[model samples]
Structures are given as C-alpha cells and as structure tokens.
Target: MDVVVIETRPLGDRSYLVHDGEVALVIDPQRDTDRVEAAAAEADVRITHVAETHLHNDYLTGGLILARAHGAEYLVSANDDVAFDRTPMADGGTVQVGRLTVKAVATPGHTHHHLSYVVSDGEDQAVFSGGSLLYGSVGRTDLVSDEDTEDLTRAQYSSVRRLAAEAQPDAALYPTHGFGSFCSSGPASSARSSTVAEQQESNHAFTDADEDHFVRELINNLTAYPSYYAHMAPANRQGPGPADLTVPESVDPAELSRRLADGEWVVDLRHRVAFASRHLQGSVSFEYGRGSSFTAYLGWVLPWNQKMTLVGSEEDIEKAIRDLSRIGIDSPDAALGTDPSALAPGTAVVHYPRVGWAEMLHGRSAGDVVLDVRRTDEYDAGHVAGAVNVPLHELLGRMAEVPAGTVWVHCATGYRSGVAASLLQRAGRQVVHVDAKYGPS
Candidate 1:
C-alpha cells in the first residue's frame, strides 16, 4: 500500500491519496483537482473514492469535482444531514479500494456531521482524523451552533481518546488542517502526525485538559470568524456548484476604477494595520491575515456579480487572488497608486510625514476634512483630534455618512488611505489622500 500526503502550503491544508495496486482513494482534496488526477494517472490506478471528513468553512472542498471527473463515489458523513449528491457514510460502514479498507468514524465536535476515517491496510491502521485533532490543538466547535458546542466537544474528546486507545500506537495520523488555519490553533509542522504514545504524553486536550477547560480556551482565543462562514456552511452543505478553476489575467487600475464607479465592489487585501492607515475611501477592506475565511466573507457581504479590484503589495497578489477564487470571486483587477480619471482635472495630491499636531491643523484649515478610517478601538487610542472615524470595512456601506467635498483621508499609514482616496474619487467625490508618515503612502 502507498500513502502520499499532499500539503497545500502557505494555506496549511493537507489532502491524502492512498492506493494499492489497482485502485486509489483521495481524502479531503483541495480546490485544484488537476494535481490529484495527475498523481492517480502517474500511479496507473483508477480513483475509486473521494471522501470529505466534514463540510469545510475554509476552502471549498474538491470532493465533488474529483468524484465527477474520475467517475468515483463521493462519500460524506451520513450524520451531516446536509444535501449533497454523494453516498452517505455512517460509522462502522466500510468502503474498499483494492487492499485498502476505509471506515467512517463519527467525530462531530467541529461540526455536527464531522467524520474521521480509519484506513486499514489489512494489518495496520491509520486515522484520517480531519479537524478533530491536530498536532497541538483540536478542531474548534464554534463553527456550528451553540446548542451543539458541548455535545460536539464531548464527542471530540471521546473520538480522540478512542483513536489513541484503539488504533495502533504507531499508526500514522493525517488531518485535513494544521497550523495557520482558522480551523486549528498552533503551527502546522511534520509534528502534525504523531504516535499514540506521543499524543498520550503531549496532547493537551487528550491528557491534561478537561472538556470545560478545552472549550474555554478555544472560545476565548477565537478571533473573529470571517463573515463568509455563515454563507460557506450553506454553500458547502449544498455542495459547491460548478466553478471554472482558471485564474483571470491581472486588470489595470484605471479599469478597476471604472468598475468601482459603476458600483462594483473594491477590496483592499492588506493587513488590518495597513488597511486602517489608508485605503481607497469607499473601498471595502478585508484582511487576508484573518485566514481563507476572507473569501467566504466577501462572498456573503459583497454581491456576486460585483466587479472587484485588489489593493496590496505585489507579494499579496497571488494569495489574494487564490483566496478570492476559493469563495467563487475570481478575476479581480490589480490596483495602481491613484486612479487618474477618478481625480479632478487638476486636483492636487499631498504627502505628509505624519498626521502630527502641525500636519492635521494645517491640512484641516486648508479645507481638507481629516478622515480616520481605522477601527473604533484604534480611533479611541488617540488619533488626530476631530478626525471622523469610518473604518475601511464600513466605508462603502457608510459612504453617505462622510461629509462631501475636498476630504483628506488618513490611516495609521498611507497605503490604506491611498486606497480610500482612489475609492472616493471613483465614487465621484472630491478628495485628497494624506500620505502621513505614520501610515503607508
């Protein structure tokens, strides 16, 4: 038997391909299905089954696509209760691919229908635990209902314990997610797979911690989930309908401005601090730092047909595009410094060292209304006095709230404020962006 683990790095998602001589089975495939197909072809085996441990809230599962392309059976947990066109798997039920026997194990803490699969090669067994367990952490229970939190957490505890006790101490452990993923806490390293003996001694949730403490730590450290989750749950439940997996050509900034003027959405894909410092005035700011959930949130909050532009450093372009594609938002145009057409015929743009006492006072008296697009918390922490707070995330929704005519917007740095200025100009509002020293230019 041969087992290959495919790691979608920078994203920290893991998928597995298990094969014997004639048939193969894939577990938790990523959105890119070509690689899986190539691997199967290279090994001279037919893919017989595609399995999803749970409905994912991060990236769209490639199970349906892989199943259709290869004419394989798509298996998901029967307990999931979501409508999907696949064979429903129950605990103890088994599927076979050559010498491999795959058994479903219900592990529902991350979600009500979550399943962990136990793979046996006649003599040895390995568990594809999914989100139920990771190297240093367990799957978060808050992705689902509060009513199921306790039940799911309890179920997870037992499931991990069962795997630790029953599966061979040497059986390899493979999970769908690792560190840097919102699904699990801690670093994703080769340490992800451990022997039962190692887990018994080092896994916190498995040993030193109780259910209540486990739940408390998870909930307390939980960052704000991407707003897209609410939508992704239902979308995944129904199965991600057909989508073209091609990356679109990069777009020009001027064209992006035209789209925004026509009421299309513009997204600033920078970090929170960069976005807060300065951004396209009316553009929506969604940080990728939050996780792949950024795509999901944009899907729910922004209109599907809305044209979009990306504003960030060159390094972020590929990731920004990939994340957007995960949620079905593709083909975003790249942003340039300023949209020339959006600017007035001769509107002057100014640069500043910082929104210091002197800069703010001078800019304000010079008919520039200082705009603070940072979050409420940031604004309260001593911003240039009198600057109005309209966080970048809320900018588009609150366009009417900002006073019209000759506005000077600034964030902690100049990058986001510049993004904000471009957005305002696209909206046909007169504005000059202040590239303060403290912010990105």
Candidate 2:
C-alpha cells in the first residue's frame, strides 16, 4: 500500500491518501483538494473513497466535494447526524478498494462520534487516528464542551490503550491533528509519523499517566481555541461549498465606503508600524505575514466563510486571498492596494502610538490600562499585574470591558498585540502598544 501524507501546515492538520495499484482513499482531507488529487494522479490511481473521522471543528473538510467530483463513496461516522449523503461507518465496519482493506475503529474521545480507520495490506497496516491517538499526546476533548471534557478524556484513555493493543506495537500511527495543531492536548513530538511501539514508549499521554491524571493534565493545559471553531462543525455537517479562489474585483471608493458603512471588516495587511502611521478610520490591522500564518491561528477571530475586503500593498492581495482560502474563507470581496486615504476619500483616518515595553512601564500612569491580547492561559501563566485579559479573537465584542483611558496593549511577543493595538486605536481609544518584552521576565 502507498500512503501519501498531506500536511496542511497552515492549520496543523494532516491528511492522508492511501492507494494501491489501481484504487486510492483519502482520509480527513481539509478544504484544499489540489494536493490530494495530485498524489492520486502521480500514483496512477483513481480516488475511490474519502473518510472523515468526525465533524471537524478546526477547519472545513473537502471529503464531500472530492467524493462528488470523483464519483467515489464518501464515508463518515454513523454517529454523526449530518444532513448530506454519506456511507455511515461504525466500529468494526469494513470496506475494500483494490488490494487495500479498510476497517473502522470507534474512538470516542475527541468527539462523541470520532472513528479511527485502519488500512491494511495483509498483516501490515496504518491507523488514520484523526485527533485521537496523536504522536506525543491525545486530542483535546474539551473542544465540544466543558462537561464532555472529562468524560471524553476518560474514553480517550481507553480508546488509545485499545488501539495500541489491537494494532500491536509495530503498526504505523498516522493522526490527523499533528505538526503545530492546537487541537492536540499537548504539543506534537515531531512533524514526522511514528509507530504504535514508538508512541507506547515515548508519548506522555500514551505511556506515563493514568486516566485521572490524564484528565487533569489535559484540562489544565487547554488554552483558548479560535472563536471561529464554534461554526466549523455545523458548516462541515451541512457539507461545505466548493473552493472559491476567485480574485475579487477592485471596488471604487463609493463601494468601499458602502461596505464599511454596512459593517464589513476592512483589514490592513501591512506591518503594524505602517498601519499605525495612518489607516482607514475603522480599519483593523491584520498583517498577512505576521508571527504565524494569517489564516491558521489568528484569522479565526473573524467570521468563517464570510467575504471580507483587504487593504494593503497591491502586491499582497493574491497571497492574502490564498492564505484565507485554506480555512474556508474564500470570498475575498476585493483587495485595495492604494493608501487608505485614497481608498476611503473624505473618511476620517486614524493612527496609534507604538512604545517599547520598558517605555510603557516607565512612561504610563496608573490611569493607563495594560491590555494583554494573548490567550487566556498565557495570561494566566504569568502576565504584568493589572493587565486586562482580552484575547485578540474576543476583542471586538468586548470593547466595553477595556478601560476608558489609555489602553496599553501587548502580547507575549508583539504580533497579536500589534493587531489589538490597531483595533483599540480604530475604536477611538487612546492606545499604546508595548511592542517589546512584556511577558514574565
């Protein structure tokens, strides 16, 4: 059997294309289908099947689209009551394509309906454990709900143990959430694949802890996930629309003004310093090439799948649109390369003051508030005393919670805080960005 690993580095999700001589299958594919199709073409095999372990919350899946396009069967956990058509799979369910034998194993930990697929050629096999038994740690159970966290975590322990015992120590372990994915209970061991024997020896969750200890460690370790996650499962359940890679039309000043008036987000994709110098009156700073990939970790703060206009250098529009498409954000209404002053003529523009951490500490008075825009867990780990904990993802709706006077914004590093500082300035707050060391030092 030929197993091709497709890593969507932007979102830290790994998909797999398993093929034999004449037929192939895809597992846990993200919205992007180009790579999957390419692998199949290279192997000279037709894609015969696509399987999803569960309703994905981290990003949209392309299973339905791939299945429709290829005239292949689509497989999903029978437990999920999705609206669309699919071959419902249960534990012990089996399917065959060419020489490959596929079997589904029920692993209810990440979600209530999660299933792990094992594809074997005679005695040799690999497990497509999507968000279940990960490389160094297990999947985060709390993504569904706080109440389900402990129960699912307990179930996870049993599930992993069962998988290791049944697959034997030698079977290859391939998981969907790895690399730098936030869905893992802890960090991945490496970007590479591992064997069940290797995980049994090295992984903390797999080898070291009991069920009670595992639950505590997992719950305590989970930080704030993306706000956009709440919408992903439902979107995937309904069956997502096809990939929209259309380069948006250039909007005139009047259209830009109308969209801004109608509550569309005008995101500035330049560096923070450039944005702070001068930008559209209400535009928010969201640089495309910041600390992380723009679409992967930080882009979830906005509405998923909704089209938003881009404001930045003319050269950046194409790359920005491609980045947004990875997470199912395809409707990039327009990209404006001109200066904000030129794009939104007669509209009021704004700017904010950027200060180093030391300057902020020495210069600001008690009346000036320090706003930490990192994750809640990051703030909890250690933060400057009296810093308001409003994560960048939750900032737009919680402006009232920020103090009235000067709001000094910061993140562990500077990228997130830069975005937050721009937002505060756009909201008419007196903003000071502590763009230097502000974490525990």
Candidate 3:
C-alpha cells in the first residue's frame, strides 16, 4: 500500500490517502475535497473508502460527502451515534481496497469512540493511528469535558499499549493530529515518519511510568484550546454541508454603515501591513491569505450573533468562505472587494501605528502600556517583562482593563498583535504595534 500525507500548514493537521494502484482509502479529510480528488487523479486510483477516526472537534470532516460523491463506503466507529448514514467500524472489522486490507482497532481516548486502523498488503503493514497515538505523545483527553478527562487518559494509555503489542514491529505509524496541531499534547518526534519499534523505545507512552502520573502531566501541560472550539462539536453533530465557494452579494457602502450600526461584523481581510496603512473605521482587521491562521482567530474573535460581511480579493473571499465554513461560519451575508474610496461619507478611514520592540522599550513610560495579546499560558511562560496579557480573543471584552493613553500591542509573532492593534485603534486608543517578529523567548 502507498501512503501519502496531506498536511494543512499553519495549523499543521494531516490527512492521508493510502492506495494500492487500483483502489484508495482517504482518512480524516478536511472540508475542501478538491485536493484529495486531485491526489487520487494523479495516483490513477479510484477512491473506494473514506474513514474518520471520530467526530472531529477541531474542524468539519469531508469524509461523508467524499464517500457519497465517489460511491465509496464511509466508516465511523460503531459506538458513535452519527447523525448521518455510515458503515459502523466495529473493533477488528475489516475492509478491503483492491488487494490491501484495512482493519479497525478500537482505541477510544481521543473521543469516546476513536479507532486506529492497521493496514496490510498481506506482508507489509502500516498503522493509521488516528489521534490515539502520536510520535512522542497522544491526543489531549481534556477537550471533551473535565469529568471525562482522567478516564479518557487512562483509556489512551491502554489503547496505545495494545497497538504496540499487536501491530507489526516495523509497521509505520501514521497519526492524524501531531504536527503542531492543538489536538496533540506534546511536540512531534520527527517531521517525517517513525516505526512501532522506534516509538516503543523512545515514546513516553511506552515507558514504565504510572498511569496517574501520566494523567497529571497530560492535564497540567495541555495549553488553552480556542474558545471557537465550543462551536465545533455541535456543528459537526448536525453535519455541516459542503463548503459554499461562491462570492457573496456585494452590499453598497451605504448599506455597510447600516449593518455596522446594527452590530453586524465587517471583517477586513488584508495583510497586517496593508490593514495597518488604512481601513474602514468600524471594521475588524483579520488578515487573510493562503496559509494564515484566519479560521481559528476569526472564529475566536467574530461575534457569533452578528451578521458578517467579508472584505477582500475575489480569490481570497472564495477561499475565506470555504475555510470559515469548516469552523461553522458557513455563510458571510455580503461582500465587497473594491477600493475603499467609495466608502460612505465620513466613514473615517483609520490608520494603525507601529514601532519596533527596541523603540517601544527605549521610549517606554509609566502610562504607555505594553499589551501582550497571546494566550494567558503563553504570556505566563515568558513575555516581555511587564506586558499585560490580554489575548486577542478576549480583548473585545477586556478593553477596559488596558491602561489609559498610548498602548503598545504585541504578540509572540506579529500576526495576533496586528489584530490587537487594529481593535485598539478602532476603539479610539492611540496604539503602536510592536512590529518585530519573535517566538517564545
């Protein structure tokens, strides 16, 4: 069997397409099915099956629709109560793709009903460890609820031990969520691939540590999941439709005023630098591009009750709607992708100011605030000495907490800071963005 990894960057989640020249199996696909179809076309194999590890909470799954389009069987755990039609993959259940065999191994830890599939071409073997096991760690058990976390952590430990004992010693491990994905609890081992034997020797999951200690470490180390995560489970339970890729109706600048007055969302989708130069006064600046962290941050920042209108290039607007749909921001009510010169009278085109970190430090004052917009945990780990920790997601509600006068907004990298600076400027603060890029230092 040939296994190809489809990695979505920025978030770094992965999907896999395993084929044997004649038939293929797609595992944990994203909402955009074009890439998967293109890969299948290039491989010259008909897609025969699509399988999901569990009901995804991070993003919408394209498996059911992909299966229907290709007349392939869609697989989900028998223990899962799916809203739509699917073939239940009971533990030890087997499916065939041409000459290759795919067997489901029940591993319920990532969710209440997660599965790890072991594939074989009679002699050679590979394990599609969907979230149960990873290179150096396993899936986070706390995403479900506080009450279920410890039980799930123990289940994860037992499930991984089962895989190590049963799967081929040299079987390749292909996990769905360890490449810097928030679903994972620790850093990835190596970028490419590792075998069962290798993971056994080095992976702490296989060590002789006590289960209680492992659970303590896992819970203590899990970083904050975005508030947008709350919307994913219910959205997936209802089953999201295929993403709508059409450009929305372009409302007049006059209508935009009325919407803004009515508390609608007018998201500005330009680069941070472009948005900093000039933008519509009441609009929220959320930079959009090919590989931006737009979906997560936009979902985190945009008010759920407000009607939204996306502003960007036609190409970007199309892709934006698709990406947004994955996180249940299905339809933007309207759109406008033209020069801002025609904006309604006195719309007040605003500007965001910037300064380097060195300049910000050198010219610092008691009242000039250094606002850090990263997550609280990130801020706690190590931030610029006295920077205030107001994560960009919470900035809308916590604007009062920022000290009066000139505010200096920054994040670990500059992406989130750009967003924070825009919000502050829109709120009538004299803000200066810390423009230099830095990681966790």
Candidate 4:
C-alpha cells in the first residue's frame, strides 16, 4: 500500500490519498477537491472512495463532491445527522477496494460521531486517525459544544488509548490534525512521521495515567480558535457545494474608490512592509505570502459574509481567493495591483512607521501605548511590560477600548501587528508597527 500526503499548509492540516497501486481512497479532503483529484491522477490510481472522519469544524469537506464526481461511495459516520446522503459507516464495518481492506473504528472525541479508519493490505497496515490519536496530542474536543467539552475530553482520552491498544505498534500513524492546526489540543510533536509504539512511548494520552488530570489539563490549555470555525460544521452538515475559485470581476479605480468610500472590506495583499510604506487610506493589510496566515486571520477578523475586495497583483489575489474559499469565504471582488494611489484615484494614500522591539522599547514615552494584539492566552503566557491587550480577533469590535495615544502594536510574530497597525491607521490613529519577533533584542 502507498499513501500520498496532501498538505494544506495555509490551514496546517493534511489529507491523505491511500491506494494499493490501482484503487485509492481519499480521507478528510478539504473544500478544494482539485488537489485530491490531481494527486490521484499523478499516482495513476482511480479514486474509488471518499471518507470523512467527522463533520469538520475547521474547513468545509470535499468528500461529497469528490465522490459524486468520481462515481465513488461517500462514507460518513452513521450517527451524523447530515442533510445529504452518504454510505453510513458503523463501528466494526468494513469495505474493500482493490487489495486494501478498510475498517471503521468508533473513536468519538473531537466530535461525537468521529471515526478512525484502519486500512490494511495482506502484509501492511496504516491508521487514518482523522482527529483522534495525533502525533503527540489529540484533537480539541471543545468544537462539539461548550456544554459537552468535559465529557468529550474524557472520551478523547479513552479514544486515544483505544487506538494505541488496537493498532499494531509498527503500523504507521497518520493523523489529519496536529500538524500546526488549531484542532490540536496541545503542542504536537514536529516529527515528520510516527508509529503506534512511538506514540505509546511518548504521547501524553498514554504517559499520563490519571484520566482526571489529563482531562483538566487538556481543557485548560485549549486556546481560542478562529472565529470562522463556528460556521464550518453547519456548512458541512448541509453539504456545501464546490468552491468557486474563479477570480471575481476586477474593479477599476473609480469602482475601487466607491467601495472604499462606502466602507467595504478592501484587503491589501502585499508585503506588510510594502503595505506600511504606502496603501489606500481605508484598505486593510492582510499580506498574502509564505508564513503569513492571510486566510485564517482575515476570515476571523472580518465580519462574516461581508463582501470583500482584494488589492494586489493578479497572482496574489487568485491565491488569496483560493485560501479564503477553503474557509467558505468565496467570490470576493478584486482590485489588481500594489500601487495604492493608482488603485483609488483622488483618494488619500496612507503610510505608517514600522519599528523593531528595540526601537519600540527605546522610543517609549509617557503618552505612547504599546498594544499587544495577540490572543488572551498568548498574552497571559508573556507580553511586553504594561502592553494593553486586545486580541486581533477581537480588535474590530473593541476598537474604542484602545487608549488615546500613538499606538505601537506587536504580536509574537509581526504578521498580526502589521494587520493591527493597518486597522489602527484606517481608524485615524497614529500607529507604529513592531515588525519583528517578540524577545530579547
């Protein structure tokens, strides 16, 4: 058996294409099904099945659409009260595709109906642990509901133990979460690969003998996830349609000006340094590039379903649209290019100063405010002395709380502070972006 890992790095998740050379099965695919199809084609395998471990809370699943397109069986947990039809899989149920035998194991943790798939040929086996039994941690159980958090966390502990007990020690452990996804409850191991034995030897689920302590620790450590996550499960339950990755109609200088004047979300996708150097007066900076979480943070901060306009080159806009679509933010309008003044004629182009930690520290004054735009938990862990905290996700709604002063904003990394700086600038506040890592100078 051969497995191909399809990584969606922007969201920090992985989907798998498992095959026995001729027939393949896709596990936990994202909304963009083209990537799965492309992987199948490249491997010279026919996709015979598409399976979802649960109704995901992170991104829309492409299982239904991919199954229909390939004439393959779509498998979902039998207990899920979804609107669409699916091959309902019960615990201990089995299916065969070519030489591979797939067994469904009931592992309710991340969600009540979650299942982990065990796929094996005659000699080799692998586990497709969608949200259960991660590399070093387990999927966050709070996504189900606030009321069910404790109960599900207990179940999560049991579920991971069960996976470790049932699967062979040598079997390859492939989890869909825990690869830098918010779905992970704790710090996940950075190891590229792990086995059941490796997990049993070091995973907290096994090392921590006290279940009560385990549950409490897991619950307490859970941090704030993206605000857009609340929409994913509902959309998945209704069976979302294909993602429209096509670029929206271009807005000329006049139309762009009108959108900006009318208070529409015109997002500028450039380097934060470039955005700070020069940008449209009202356009917000959500720089789209490597290591920048343009999709998640933008979707989180922006009002849900708000009509947004992108400002960047055609390539950047296209990439931004695709990333946004994965989180169900689709068909956003675009203004193609980086020159802020040219994009909106007669409108004021704005600029802000970006400083490092040293500059921010040395230039501190009695009236100047240091705004820490990280999450509450992140701020609680450590922060700049006397820095006022209003997380980036909550900044839009609580802008009034920010003190009157020249604000110097910073996050653990500068990506979020860059965004915060732009928002502050848009709101007519004097701002300096601390565009550097947070630590000793």
TM-score of every candidate: 0.71, 0.91, 0.93, 0.98
lDDT of each structure?
0.68, 0.82, 0.81, 0.91
- lDDT tens readout by residue for model 2, 324-428: 665667767674675887887877777778888778767888788988888888887788887789988888789889978888899977778888887777677
User: Cα deviation in Å at residue 4, candidate 3?
Assistant: 2.9
Clashes of 1: 23
Query: What TM-score does structure 2 among the candidates reach?
Result: 0.91
Best by TM-score: 4
Order by TM-score, highest first: 4, 3, 2, 1
lDDT of 1 by residue, 103-167 (tens): 88777778777788888898878878889877766777777876776677777777778766657
Off by over 4 Å in 1: 185-192, 247-255, 267-305, 310-322, 330-441
Model 3 poorest ten-residue lDDT run: 337-346
Worst 10 residues of 4 by lDDT: 160-169
Q: Write the per-residue lDDT of candidate 3 for residues 319-367, one digit (tens) a residue.
A: 7887787776777865566455465445777787777767777877777
The candidate, 2 or 4, that scores higher on lDDT is 4
Report the C-alpha displacement of residue 231, candidate 3, in angstroms.
2.4
